[model samples]
Target: MKKNILYLSIAVIIGLIGGYLIFGNSSDSSNQKITEVHDHSEDSTNEMWTCSMHPQIMQQEPGDCPICGMELIPAEASSEGLLANQIQMTENAMALANIETTIVGNLMEGNDDGVISLSGKIATNEENNAIQASYFDGRLEKLNVSFEGQVVKRGQLLATIYSPNLVAAQQELITATSLKQSQPALYKAVRNKLKLWKLSASQIDNIESTGEVRENFPLYATVSGTVAMVMAAEGDYLKQGQPILKVSNLNSVWAEFDAYENQISQFKKGQKIKVATSAYPKKEFDAVISFIDPVLNSSTRTVTVRSTLKNNENLFKPGMFVSGKIKGTAQSAEESLNIPASAVLWTGERSLVYVKPNPNRPVFEMREVTVGLRNGDNFTVVSGLENGEEIVTNGTFTVDAAAQLQGKKSMMNKSGEKTMTGHEGHLGMQGDSENKSDAISTMKMKLPMAFQTAFQAALKPYFKMGDAFVASDASQVSALAKTVLAKMKAIEVGGLGKMEKSHLSKSIAMLDAISSSSDLEKQRAQLVVLNENTVALAMNIKSPTETLYVQKCPMANGNKGAIWLSTEKEIKNPYYGDDMLTCGSVIDSLK
Candidate 1:
């Protein structure tokens, strides 16, 4: 009996030990799973997501871009190993944003003409200006020169002046002439005194011959010019050497151009310039740089560049708008480099440009550049850029936005400061759900009613395609996409605005992408972009022919969320047709 009790006890002890070993591990695993769940929830709350194309979009969770419909990316700071000023952009983001780059080439190599255009106006040549003054004190009796701008020739009759002193001098001359037989020296002196009064030899001889003193004396013009100013009025008393008329020789004029301080080096005296004017746009006049003012204009921050032009045909007029083109004197490739002005971002004193160091891939780094003279669309890079480098010329703002999101040196964040989750800085949609509700609020243009009508008229086939996608028929979707693309293209854009046209063209690109794909999911992905443009267009319509409901599926687009327009209020998500058929909600309505 003792041995039997001991065997039972040993068996029970082993069973208890085995049972404890099995159930304890299972319980610890359950506890570990709970812990992991709690940790994952914390991470989800902490991590932030943002769109690569539209950096302004910030959400607490991963989702599609509200503005551009691109996939959201982790809005984390770039690695410390990378350059602080460098930014990394996905290939898809670059393509979708239409970011284009230009290869920086030698300014002289690319531009053979090497001409800089300058805006200026025609002015009177001060060197050729002359003032007509009275030789003696007098009162104007008769004014012959009628008005300003009257053409006058040398030795032409200007006006008649009545001078008391001239009448006395004429009487003295007559008296001296009467005693000429007795006093020959006195007669010669009297004639010399009349000559000193600007009287011609014939007039003095006539006075002596007639023996009569004239009350009024005739004044003649000494220089040929146009009357610019009539200084004295008729019958007004005038002092000796007082101006009668201000005359300007209009045969020659000055082409005065405003040159910025940076452009001063490009100009020098005697440089050839081709001047053109709006008055005679078909003709160009040759001019030479006569002078460059040493002083700068404080108010305008410019210097005066004067060029002499001949106006024999009277084509050039004072105060007329003119443009001048000067050929670059130093055309060698070594002198300097040029870049598109659009590529540069100007800060108060600093200028910046995004440079792609690697030609094969889309890797960009911010480079602070020192820019000089601006020649129309291009700028001279005095420093901070090299030849054969590629720079972002178009979509510069988008690139800077990417840089700011990535915590790199950007136009808005030049110090490479890390953005605060990108939510506070950018006025972004807060969460995934709210972003869907605000997706259609991208931007609306004031389109013409005619364009809006035509745009709505073309949506019939597109609406059918949406229904086809919801039915999960890939073939039907592709076929209808072609029709939609054609219909959208066929719409007349007689009064469409530029922004509206850009949206239409971009939507066409999206449709082309959708029509060429045979896969349903791919078509749906492209449709997101098309819907973005379409919804914006619909929002501009005051009375759309067909009402549209902007429906969104939070579980679609890789669980990132995607939106589409539907005629029905019911949620029928085309993104995940039949799989999660009613997995969306109506976020907006357009009528």
Candidate 2:
């Protein structure tokens, strides 16, 4: 009877403990669910609708714009919504987008001096030039403005012309003076005829008094300036209505500058420019924009900008090399955000950038921004982003790829529904599957020619060396390896894409192995091994991936050109083993 009673008490204790644990767990679960539900509901209620083209307008509900009938887009929940065209993304999506943020302070003021100096040469002001020509028929005589660079004043004697026509008119006047009594009307008509030849009244009176015709007549200057050119010198036969001299006002000069096509918009009329010259290093002359060439130079692909400078001390001379800083105001007067030019993805029509939303999570979204003035590598942000927002300045392509994967409007697409292929894989981090999707989209954008050349040049040497090794040619292999090193050393790889750098890095590493080989046999053997690896890499390599053919190629002596890529395997070459591929691979490869 006592054992049964102990068992009953233990069972009762166990039941009570089970009941207490189940109820306590249920209460905590209910509280957690309630908290989550409250946060989700708050987010749903605060959602806003905005126009993609007009981000400043915000509406509580989704609808068409009263002004423009364009569809409304969803606004980001964070401060990103305040930006121009911020596209919100999830944490995982952001990681795939490669959206990176950095902390930066506002530029309260900029230094008066420009960070970069542009050099150009001084030239004649075409607008202030004049050409002197004869108004009447003339012959060989004398020229006052004998040579170029001679100064002349207004009404000054330019040259003396001997004209048979003028001599005949003078004789008529003298004859008329003697025959005045016989024919007064005929004398008056003869006298008036001489006036039509641009003769002075004093010269006519001298002709009548002397009763003889002068062989040579003097010509006077129309305008005062420095003689730029003397077409006719002393004792040269001259014709009627022919240019005699070319003159220009030296008081004002033109400083012509060649601006890159990308920077043409930054220059305009009436803007201020501070000019200095290596010839006169101590002097800093001030000038203002007077004219900009309407057309771009087809050969140089640059725009010509002309600034007018007053040459008070005759310090500015034509053809003198000069350096200067241009102080230009933003095209838009309204205050707007500014970011590094490297942050923008220019797609010809629209400009895009990735803005970090959460600094703690390092999350960002793709945003379409309007740009105003492009001052060097920096641009003025007219719209699309707000102050205090984190932006991706470096590795913009990396972040743009991530955006494409997330189905957000990226540098390539806005809907994010399209799959972009055929992009040359550049260098950078690959986060996950989603990151790959985004990277593929971002790669669709075309890169600058300079960047493409740099990427390919890096891989040329490695591939060449690897091919040489595979062929079992010890001398050729050694030469090829050394050539790769020389090419890499000579190549200027300072600025390039991330994908390009990654491929080049791999190719360069392989070249480094070849370089360290002590003997020809050893180098050949290593190259053979490298060749197998390179072939394998080529099979798997994707388009839009950095390759050497676009930048660099092999050389006859195995040495690379001065401007080459660091890697060699990434070069996409069809003539891998073809003889004489190196000699003409690149144009002017020495430096």
Candidate 3:
């Protein structure tokens, strides 16, 4: 609920604070116009609105934002800076996003050392674990330890069993007793044989003194611990040395963390680590790294680093997600310059951050930095930064987005100048293929070639699903959705920018929803949103080799209109299939 309000407050804060800042000493009538300011032309006052969260949506009148369902607010365009790669944001916009910045100093000048963060989970202490098993073959007559997590004590009565072997052994003792006078050696051997089966000496003496045979016997607990698993059931036949329960001592537990292959050299046994858990967020438990796995996990490329934690207070539970913080990443005696991890945008081998050239203004420009040793949530900047510089520590994505919108240098657009194709409409919706316009006013950045080429390959199955949808074959759509989803998942996201990642993630989610159901209407409904995101993604591709046309059907999405990408300029409507085949116009193309 609070998150929803925060999103809504962005527009409200911008409208209120921005209205006063832009038009001070204005009349109440002029201030009222701020809520629904006109776009397109000066005479078109209150005639249009756009989404606050999604700026792509531009409608003729006020309505709920189609993408996020938030109420539409009047759109405002801001001018870019004259300097290269520089962009500015209004104080209202900054306040609306709740963006914050921090001035970083060289850690090399300070005495503080960096800390390493590790992700792991709590596990049982394996050394203290034991198995409780039966000593001899028998039928379980009764079981006292019936459930997992049950506590047991040493020498406690655990179960009762009926053993035919013990019954026959008793008969042997009875028969041997008669010959004891003549065969004292046989008597001694029979008594010692019962001991091998874990029978008490008193039990052997009772049968001999009473001259009777016992069919049932009691089993006792061998160790004291909490039962981790119950392996046996009442009335079940048990074999000799068969396990009945798995028990583990809870006095101490193991906090095992998976350290990446690159981070393995920094970790060593006997190093002190401070562990924190979600259950106890405020507290940190001190533990020593007792063991590190000798072999690295081949698939995960990580090694298990184990720490023994005392749970005398019963604070830790097995399977709880935990984090381990290790200090001392600083190799140099003098601490190096470090900034919060959030301040850096890491893409492949490069690290980028938005630096405020002037400390007093909201101006920001992207800078590529060389990062060295990383400690916990901070990274040491080896180059491209200076002490006393203010960098964006939060809302880095927002700032990058603002830069891209203003045609300034961004994570996606590394160049200081705009790159454009003479295409009409921002999202390929304003003009048909026959009437393509040369208006290239918007920031003309395209998705990187590596990402675009990979995505194009993955979208092959997606286009096939569109064909299936055009044929009204729900089953084929479901199958193709799964195929495309797999291909999409296989796409390498290591070098993709944040915006590309978001679009790809959303497209994958839409495909998942489409494949989960076999209903044609439901699949088409998901396709509507899928096409929107994919179409936006396709707009980012620069000079694509494969031809892809953005086709739109006016009657789709309940008359709100929708667009889909196709390989050819010829439109085949997937929304209505046979009902409205070839009903769409080609709005844009990628070639």
List candidate 1 segments past 4 Å from native: 1-82, 88-99, 106-110, 262-267, 294-303, 329-331, 358-363, 401-407, 411-414, 418-591
User: Which residue pairs in model 3 clash with each other?
Assistant: 107-335, 108-335, 115-376, 447-540
**Residue 544 shift from truth in candidate 2, angstroms:** 24
Q: Top lDDT: which candidate number? A: 1
Off by over 4 Å in 2: 1-109, 112-128, 139-150, 153-162, 177-220, 228-240, 253-309, 318-334, 357-365, 375-377, 395-409, 417-591
Write one digit per residue (lDDT tens) for candidate 3, span 1-591.
999999899989989998887667576567667644643356475555754334445677787654334567765554445477777776655765457898878433443465677767789998999998988889999999899889899989999999998888889999999999999999888888888887788888998999988788888887898899999999999999999999999999999987766677788888999999768879999999999999987644568999999998888888777778886544642446788766776443457899998877778889999987555546778889887888998767667766666577766566745432111223333333354432212224456677778788878888899999999987678768867876776677776655466567757766756764557997887797678667777777776668877777867865656788899887789999998898978756667
Tens-digit lDDT track of model 2 for 533-580 = 233223233343443222223231122111122234333322233443
Relative to the true structure, candidate 1 has a C-alpha RMSD (angstroms) of 19.8
What is the Cα root-mean-square deviation between model 2 and the actual structure? 20.3
Encode model 1's per-residue lDDT on 1-591: one tens digit a residue: 999999999999999999989999899999999999999987875587777556766688887676546678766443444577777776766766678898888434556456787767788988999998888889998889979989999999999999999999999998987799999999898888878777788989899889888898999888999888899889899898899999999999999987777788888999999998757769898878999999986544569999999888888878776778898565533567888766876543467899988787667888999987777557888899888888998767668767776677765455777543222332233346443345334454678777777677668888888889889886677667766776776676667764466567657756755654556876786787577667767767788766788777767655555677778998887887788889988767877
Regions of model 3 farther than 4 Å from truth: 1-84, 106-112, 178-189, 276-284, 297-302, 312-315, 320-323, 332-334, 346-349, 370-376, 414-591
**TM-score-based ranking:** 3, 1, 2
Decide which is better by TM-score, 2 or 3: 3
